[model samples]
Target chain A: MASNDLLKGMLKPIILKLLLENGKMYGYEITQLVKEISGGEIELTFGALYPILHKLEVEGIVKTESEVINNRNRIYYSITQKGNSKAKEKIAEFEEMVKTLKVFFKPNFGLKYEFIG
Target chain B: MNSLDSKHIRLIEADVENARITINNLSQELVDHICCEVENLMSSGKSFEEAYTIIKEQAGIKVLQQIQENTLYLIDKKYKTMKSTMKITGNVSLALIAIGTALKIFHYPGASIALLLGFVTLCFVFFPAAIYLNYTYKKDQKKPMLNLSILIGGIAFMIGVLFKLMHWPGASLLLFVGWSIILGIFLPILLFFKLKEAETGKERSIYVLGVIGLITFEVSTMFKVFHWPGAGPLMILGGVLLIAVFLPLFASMKFKKGTFTMPQFIFLITTSMYAVVLTFLLAMNVSDVVMDRFVRDEANSTKIANYFKNKKTVAANDSTIKVSTELAERTDNIAKLIFDTKIYLITNVEGVSESVAMKYVSDPDLINNKSNYDIINHLLEGENNAGLINSLKKELNEFKDKAISVSTDPALTKSIQELLNTSDKQMGIGGATWEELNFRNTMIISAMAQLSEIEKNVRLVATIVK
Candidate 1:
């Protein structure tokens, strides 16, 4: 659950990146894609996902349309041009942050030191 | 399997029912999500009971409840934002009221409509919006102070409306009392609680003192309206109370906080000043108008005496020397008394112009004093050793001629003619003395000249007295 907090920060960029590539997705479809990508380890609640989707819609970063699928009305959301640009920038920043952190995790090649009194 | 399907259907119905209760208690969005998950599971080859249980476990009851609360919180946040906008609108309306009030006071032609609109906004719009906001936020329960404000605002509105419609004396005092209660007592108290609740009590004591000042103002106004003594002292005491209690409290608060808002200082200073100014003006204006009426009456009597002196011959009756003498002496004494009283009043009272004082003395129709014709007739008949009937007659003719010269000015002429005509009618022919007949005839001529003046000037006099 605590690890999910770190993942949650990247979820919008990930979803936005996916939508920019795929064009549009429904709520259930987005959840499935996220689960498949994480090998079913990460689960996103519809309650959490819907609000962000609605907020993005309200902020003009996303647009939605409803269509009848299998006798149910499924709402599909697509990233706007603004959302695509934001996703691109966020992904670049994420990659930069990962590269920066990679240096700290590497072993240092310094001479061994004896314990001092 | 058929039995299983029936059992599943029953469970599904029960789940839907339970979800309805949850929706009522929690957020509809969460229930809808749970319902969707249950439906999805049922479609994926699970029995209804199994699907319901599975979905219920997937979203832990506690997490579901928390999510529900969060959703409600979000909705409430949106509602609060909308309400705040409405409140801003209400405040704008209140500001418009103040602007309208200012325009009205400056003598704008449409000031009456503005005043009406201002009162309407205060009563119907701003006050009710405050109440509605308090209710919507559920602040009415958590903050009893808000309720107090609403109550005070409603009462003040009612009293304000009543004050406007009625011409009751001391209405302004009522208005002042109402203002003090709302702005001073209720608002300050509410603000105090708000500050205290926010843990910002540095200026709480100062606000409390402001409230005390307001209460004192209210009490003083009450005293003034009821005509109770010590009203002045009470008002002074109230002013002192504000300075003594509020000023020190304000200083201490400022020392502690190192800052205060501009509005806080403005409200404090303006309220104190308003209290003092209003109380003083009310006391002065109301008392002065009442006192002035008495002085005006006295001056009017003296003027009536002078008019009588100018037209004495026209009023003289020659029924007998003894009767005429007594009447002339009585009229003379009354005239002297009126004139002396007017002089004394003018000397004593401030704002009583000598001309205005003299106007009261010079008013020709003061029924208590003898008319101008009476004085003239007295002199003509040689009453009280006032000799020379011919001289009195000439003087009467001269005054008549002067009156006639202006009589061409329609208003003056019409007024004079009306006076003469009324007097002539009153002086009938039967049992009248020769002097009375001549006086009535002269008055008739004077009236004709005055009517000619009115016709020339194109003015009308509805009533005239000689």
Candidate 2:
């Protein structure tokens, strides 16, 4: 519900960026940080976040460590040494794409429809 | 910040369990995440119940299960391809079958081709892909034998349907196995699962009602396909249960709860479309089966008459041959005219060419045209109409005279006269002419059989004279 599926594709890099900056964060903390940083424009539902986190874990881009808090276990995700570089690469790649996409937003509109090629 | 105690943690865990989060890592993450969310909300003066309700809205069971499905799908490339294949072939077959059925009802050409392509796509591509994807889904969920019976039953049923449409052998075996597995094994397993999963009394009743209705409808489909008795009562019962009892109750409940989702919408359309098309294609009613028997009778008479012709050729003397020559030619003329009429009926009715019509009627069991009496009547009947049947009738009366003159024996001459009679006298209560009595109410296939029978009798009378 956070991004209405538009920000959904960008979540993987966002999570990796958050993990790189925080060094170590639990699931709830990551979500709250995202909401706060995006000025409540983004809400990371645990449903979407955990799958990406688990996939990152499986891919060795991030790793998990568990601690028993209250009656259940809290899993903390942190970027690995390899993930540190991968996170920067993914974030830069996304930033470059977005910067280039801005060109389309200000394009001369409907100028070509008259040609009828 | 207030933290959750053991009791609050158990409550969160119970809700997570209700989502069927079977994966250990995913389950742990969800319970802990909800607990953290609830605690943070509690710190802001919200009660535990209020916070939990807010969390459940975002992470409902449907969302949680979808995450698990997506994660599993992401991990396997082959599964993704098969899943896409399942979707593509299913839709393609649906499109082809819809087009095919429309064409068939309108008596257009290419109906058989479209239907064949549709059935082939369904039986070979979609069913296999669907089974593989379902198996992969069950494996990922760690639910053993979850969709086994339904998958097997569906594949068998679809393949059996394909075979039956093409009039291929071994369809009965496949249909029997398919129906047995669905009715005997899958329905019972489904019933047990529904009972175990449904929580409330209303939910249980609805589930049981749905299963009973589906089973009864499927049973009637089975009975109708196999031409067994009791299909009518069962069909009516199933229709009442589904339409009167089940749909009203079920749809009302869903409307009240506002729980209808996109998948349910697709499922409703696809399932009903499939049932309608299957019942229409698979019924193989009484008239069609009787038509096959007439085709067989025509074939038998032709074979016997050919045997007599071969014998007559070997045994004939010069004088006898000369005497019966006119009779033979007239018989051959009428026979050729009748064969042309049969082909004309098929080509016009099916919108196919002469060559294609030949191919269609060459296989007796596979003939589907020649059933429309109204169009045939329009084509072949009227007072003083110069249709092929009238010309053939005129040719027959002349041939009857030829047969009577050519024969040496008086008894044989009388029998040939009776056999070749096309008189206008009323044979029954009807005030109809000889043409109307024979071809008006009768199917084209039955008429064709009678024409061939006349040809056979002509050949026999000629052979006896020789």
Candidate 3:
């Protein structure tokens, strides 16, 4: 399981990427998909997730539309044009950060891996 | 897999309400989220109550509230910026007003600029910012309409009051709108809601009576500011309701509910404040010393006005217009100067018009030893009247200098010198006993006699000059 502190910084980019692919999603569906895809390893608390979603909405990266579904008012969030462009930029940044983390964490055995290859 | 029915969904919604989600949109979103989570759990073969318990235990009440808190934080960033700006500007403006008022009192520099900056910031920046912040906060709390009305009315009333206090423009319209909205709409709606929200008849009566007291107090102040009638009665009634009825009722309610600990302290503090205000009002209304001054001031003003009116009449009569020669003209001018000086005394001492002043001077009963002797004596003798006397002395000195240069007549010069001497003698009336009120009246009478003599001599000098 990923630590919450570690997951906190990556949650926005991850959600943006999910929206980029899924086209549209409500809060419960997004939470369920994240749990499913991560195989229950990365559980996002609604407490932590809602704020990030709201911040994105405030930044105009996402827009919401409410509909009554099964006698319930469900609000669905979709990526805007601004959100699409921002998602691409954020995904690229996240990939680069991951690469940097990989280099720092990989066991070197006292030699650079590229030189060994 | 089993799914919860509509009644079970309502239970979930009630739980969300219990979580204290005040924002309407946020509450709806939260309800939907919780419903989906619980339904998913129920579909996995747990019963409705079992699924609900599992979901609630996993989320925890604190975390459920945190979601709402985070949303609020995100939205509040925009509001917080304005709120801080309003607070800063309000504080700065208040400081400037305080400094400016102090400087103005002491006759120092930078007073006007400071006052203008303070007033402008308070009226424009701080007040608008406050209105915006108040509007946004209230909007989220399910009373957007009431909030907007209060914000507009409160801001308008405050700005109008500021303008009226500073004697600026556009106070009338602002005041009219502000009073109408606040008194007519906002307060009634607020009281209606307050009464509606109360669970019991006791609570309802308490809210209604409390609001009546507060409204009566506000109306009393409004009446006083506009100089309308019923200020006194309204004030007394408000004070009685607040101190006698509202405070005790409020305290008793709190006691019944076991919510009396911290609230008891608040009640005591509020009661103390009300007591202080009531005492001050009583002192202002009932103190004989204060009322005596007011009555004396009014009477003196009327007498001064009468005195000046009679003088105008006497002067307009054809018999008194005999400035036919240069010497007589000079004498007439001198007499006019003496009368002008006397006018200064009457106006400054009695604060009355010319006709009223003539009546005061002629009415022997008014300046007699037994009646109003203390007042007349104090006006002539006390430090209160010294400012007028000092200014009079300066005017007389300037006249002397100019008359000496213009007139070669020793008689006119001597008359001017004698008038100056009588002014000095009047100044010496300070330490005299209250029993010497008769002596004080005699001094004023003799001064008038000297003035008449000066006028007669000026007429006699007309033949000499011709």
Candidate 4:
């Protein structure tokens, strides 16, 4: 689990990852899925989801379709072909970050103390 | 799960519209999201009202506006910079214009410089940046013509104000056209869009009233600019409609709905203050004191010239008589040439016939556009600088040499040379010839007064020769 503050810069990749897993998703569905995946450790706000989705659509990484369902308009976002490579790249970058950060969690505490002394 | 009736959907729609979401399609997305949230909550045994209350707390106006801001910020790379530039330039130009107007009202120096800089920056930088930012914020709204009209009309109005303050020509044309566009093009289109999006009859009435008031106010402003009759009644009527009728209604409606924001309040106050300032600027009149002074100076020089003209030369010897006669002829030639030049300047500046110019030359206040230097530039400094004024300058200098050669007193010769010298005078700046110094940008009355002064000098030297 990670602090929600850590989710700020990584929201795009998380959203892309979710879009890759599910071929298409609405804004509320993505929020619910992120909360479920992180086991409530990361809570996406009720208002913060659409900007990233809209930006992804603007960058041509995703596309949107608006449909009338149950007497209301619902927008669904789906990843484009361009988003596939971007998703893989972002996942690899996240993996690299996790791998580099793992060193701090390893048993190197006593080694650093000995080297400083 | 509870499904919403059409009535409930309309409630959601009104709530979204109440947010006044400016971004394209944002209200739709937010309304749909809230509907889904409410339906989900209702399935958990909550009533429709309870679910909707919870949803309303989450999707407030501030939150919706924040989402729109974030989306625009993410999509536009230059948004932050453009916004900052618009703010800085708007404030800077406003300050400059305020200071310039204060200085001009007090007749202090540097007012023109400040006004010029303020207008240039406002028209060129601040206006374009503001319009660009506004257009980008609502890029998908399909109202490009609204922005386009505002850009053109706003720029034209600003430049017209500047030119009017500077006493430049074509100000009336620009002011008229700018206001016409705003009245005819901008207001009509804005009213159409507002009417289309209006939810209540009250809102539609307010929008219509506002447009009618603006049209009346703009037309009255044009009438005031041209000083046409009935401008006063029209101005008062328009002001009453806007200040007394439209503004309070609009404010109360917004405040009652809790949609009034801090920026809107600030904008209203500033706009009222701006309109008052504009009214004062329109009422301002150019001072005639400088023109009166030139007229007085010309009259004094004329009196001195007549005294010199009537003075009889007392010649004790025959040689002295010949020298004095020749000197008088030369002085009269120079003086007549100066008078002809004045007549020529008047005819060319006013684009009138020679006879009318000759009649009007003695009273130069009758000539409009007194500061137009195009005729002077053409006659005195033409493309090659060897204009007709060069010949006049040469003849005057020759007169100076002739008087000097005839005089035996060294002091007298020295005074004559100094009095009639027409060589290039380096005033404050550099490299302007004598003709450029005198005639360039000089008012016609002042130019005529200047010729009068020159004629007096030539006469003074002639008396010395006698």
**Chain A only TM-scores, each candidate in turn:** 0.77, 0.84, 0.89, 0.84
Pick the TM-score winner: 2
Of candidates 3 and 1, the better by DockQ: 3
**Per-residue C-alpha lDDT of model 2 across residues B1-466, encoded as one tens digit per residue:** 8889899888777666756665547788888887888888899999998998897787776787788777766655676788788889999999998898788868777777898899889978987777666655543234335467777787788778777765568987999999999899888887787788777889789989988988998898888767677775687677668767877677767656545555875687578657754554444444454656667677665555444433432345676677678777876787788778878877776676788778756654445554567867766674567888899888888877765554555555555565666777655586677777667766666666666777776667665554
Angstrom error at residue B433, model 3: 13
Give the TM-score of candidate 4 (chain A): 0.84
Q: Which lDDT value does model 1 have at B227?
A: 58
Candidate 1 per-residue lDDT, tens place, B1-466, comes to: 1123344444433433332223222233344355566667777788766877787666644455455444444445655565565567667656766676565434355545555565666666556665755554432456665576656655564555445433234555556666666765576667667467434455555566676775676677666655566666677677677766677676566545423445657776688667677776666554443344346446544544443434333322343344434434433443343344344333222123566556534441111111124343443345553434333333333333444443224544443443323222244455654345433323212222222332222111111122
lDDT tens string, model 3, B1-466? 3455789878777667656666546777777888888888878878877888888776654566677766777766876578678889999999999997776544467766788788778878887787675566543366666677777787788777666644456875787788778877887888888887787998999999988887787677666555576676787787788778888888888667533456545869687676748654543543333345457446544544443333222222233233222334455556666666555455444445787656655542232111223334444444854533344344445544543343344554454344333232233556533224212543343334434543443343233212
TM-score of chain A, cand. 3: 0.89
The residue pairs that clash in candidate 2, if any, are none
Candidate 2 wrong stretches, greater than 4 Å: A1-10, A41-48, A81-85, A88-117, B1-24, B31-57, B99-114, B138-146, B198-209, B247-365, B369-466
| Model 4 Cα lDDT, one tens digit per residue, B131-191 | 8877766542588889999899988888988887665778878888888888889999999
Q: Rank the models by lDDT, top first.
A: 4, 2, 3, 1
**Each prediction's Cα lDDT score?**
0.51, 0.74, 0.65, 0.76
Winner by lDDT between candidate 4 and candidate 3: 4
| Winner by TM-score between candidate 3 and candidate 2 | 2
- The numbered model that scores best in lDDT is 4
B268: Cα error in model 2, Å: 3.0
Give candidate 4 misplaced runs (Cα > 4 Å). A1-5, A65-68, A102-117, B17-28, B44-46, B76-114, B132-146, B192-202, B223-236, B255-466
User: What is the C-alpha DockQ of each candidate?
Assistant: 0.04, 0.53, 0.42, 0.55
Q: Can you give the lDDT of residue B218 in candidate 3? A: 69
